[model samples]
Target: MTLRSEFGREGNVWLMPGGSLLSAALAAALVVVGWDVVQLASEEALARAAKEIGPTGRLVLIADTQGRLPDPRAALAGRPRPFVVAVGAGGAFSTLADVVERRVAAAVLDADRPFADLVAALDSLLRSTPVAHDANRLVARLRQREDEARRFFGLTPREQHVLGALIAGRSAAEIAVANQVSMPTVRSHIRAVLTKLGVSSQLAAVALAHRSCREPTLLERMREVHQL
Candidate 1:
């Protein structure tokens, strides 16, 4: 399921990878138990989204061990990471020995287990104490800021993408290559982005965009990854 699907459900946020039967089943189970499930396209997207959630927000990171999971330490670094749960065939859980040793993951189950057993494990993990704010509220606030920034600055989607590339420290040539556009075109987009954001230079634009989004920092990351 995409992020836009069934938003604002009254429960924890279940971040899952897209296109997996396990993910689909787990998402359904979590939804039945009042979790707002968000299926992202990749591990990077999942990690980035997870960072936006607050301490109080119950976040369950569900990953299949097809080898796309990020280093739990790096992905969960510098923030209060969610409870990670990995399930897959074979010795999938063994690969995450370090993660489990560090107590970063709540549980790692075998995919061969019955769906009911997996759900039961999730239920047990869900009993952990919750903190302060809701993940939905955080997500909504982030969306509001992004909408406000776009509205106030009159930034088009393409302009937002250009701005994101600039924020990532990508040069005009790099942006052109990434976006498959001409150097002149990339420069033109940069100029438009800077003008719309009311910034004098690329550096200023990046700083302004960061300030405009403020907390979460996920917005900036998302812009760079998903092009907003």
Candidate 2:
């Protein structure tokens, strides 16, 4: 299966090589769950890696980092499941180890993760995500998703803009200036977003908006990877 297909389910998402997502999934599945592993990396790389790990799933396309990651609040909106969602700064998860604290059902960040740093962070995170039998992390994550979905649905474009700004940790005045709108307009947008998102406070608004965006494109990832 492709990265999207393999990891579409709920699970702890980590910060690592985009290709590693596929590798980890397959390794966890076939090796641990008695099934074949799928890969989403380049054909040559997959072929070479297959020799090391063995093949199980077919590749539909080379990895394509499409869409920006959902705002942190939005990450809570994704369907309930445990999976890692890594994103680089330009659009990748720098260090989602904490987010995936075993209890983290999924990570929702950028798509421009650095190979070396990502691997190191994920290794460390694997140690953190609660693995205890009594942990209810997945349940909490599911609740978060429902909450985010209810908040963002039918939000107007301006409301979305306002929420996006809040997700950036911007102040209402800053949002107004950045959006080139009036202060009242920004506040109105904020109120509207709050009402729609079912949140009573602005801080909550910012947190939710952070998880709603998706990953950036491959081109965008490359630019960010190079600090371009």
lDDT of 1 by residue, 1-228 (tens): 533225345655555555666677777777776666676656567567655655554445445556334344455567776656655442233433434554555454544344687777776666656343343444454344445355324766777777766767788899999989999898888888777766689988776655454222425463445443
Give me the displacement of residue 228 in model 2, in angstroms.
Answer: 11
| TM-score of structure candidate 1 | 0.45
lDDT of each: 0.58, 0.43
What is the per-residue lDDT of model 2 for residues 132-169, given as tens digits with 9 covering 90 to 100?
33324534553455455444556786776666556555
Worst 10 residues of 2 by lDDT: 54-63
Using lDDT as the measure, which candidate wins? 1
Error of 1 at 13 (Å): 2.4
